[model samples]
Target chain A: MKARIKVTLKPGVLDPQGKAIQNALGALGFDGVNDVRQGKYIEVDVAGMSEEQARTEVERMCRDLLANTVIENYTYELAP
Target chain B: MKARIKVTLKPGVLDPQGKAIQNALGALGFDGVNDVRQGKYIEVDVAGMSEEQARTEVERMCRDLLANTVIENYTYELAP
Candidate 1:
């Protein structure tokens, strides 16, 4: 099975990389761009687990390592 | 408006960071993990554009600045 995790910054968190991208967009003439936030997406392959088990395991992985709980939120999908 | 972009490695590309994370997961005792691939997610806020326009603008941004078309693929979503 495979699990995909999307980790995003919580609302109101400062994102320096996002700000940098926004400025770069302005420099590149992409007018009207006002703000930007950057995040991470991770895909993992797991063996010997049912779909439900895989989701649970990946959720724990997100909490323990993939995401910073104090500033980020994560959601995941599991697939065979 | 807001646009969200996901940038992922093309199949067959080497991913050192993904490998590192996989090793870390194994060390942390998340068993049955076989592989890991990492990607990027970005969100941008734009003003003065219709949804269609925003998508087009972001598509161009991905092609020209945000993504390395040779090795990565990027998809984006636009929302009010």
Candidate 2:
């Protein structure tokens, strides 16, 4: 099974990278750009687990290691 | 409008970061992990554009600056 995880900064968290991107975009003449936030996407392949089990395990993985729960939020989907 | 962009490495590209993460996971005792790929997620806020316009502009952003077209693929969605 394959699991995809998206980890994003919680709203109100400072995102310097996002700010840098926004500025870079502005310098590139994409002037309409406003607030920007950057995050992470992770795809993991797992074996010996049903789809549900994979989802559960990956969720645990996110909570325990993949995401910094204090300032980030994560959501994931699983596929066969 | 707000847009979410996901950029991922093209298949067949060697991913040292992914390999490192996989090894780290194994060391952390999350044993079933197989192939792991890491990517970037970006959220952008734009003004003076309709949903369609936002999508078009963000797609261009991906092509020109957000993603390296030679080795990465990007997809995005826009929301009001």
Q: Output the number of the DockQ-best candidate.
A: 1
lDDT of 2 by residue, A11-47 (tens): 9999999999999899888978879999999999999
lDDT of 2: 0.90
Report per-candidate DockQ: 0.85, 0.85
Name the fnat for model 1. 0.93
Cα deviation of A48, candidate 2, in Å: 1.4
Q: What tens digits encode model 2's per-residue C-alpha lDDT throughout B1-80?
A: 88989999999999998898898888888878989999999999999977787877898899989999999999888888
Q: Grade the docking of candidate 2.
A: high
Q: Which stretches of model 1 miss by more than 4 angstroms?
A: none
In candidate 2, list every pair of residues with a backbone clash.
Answer: none
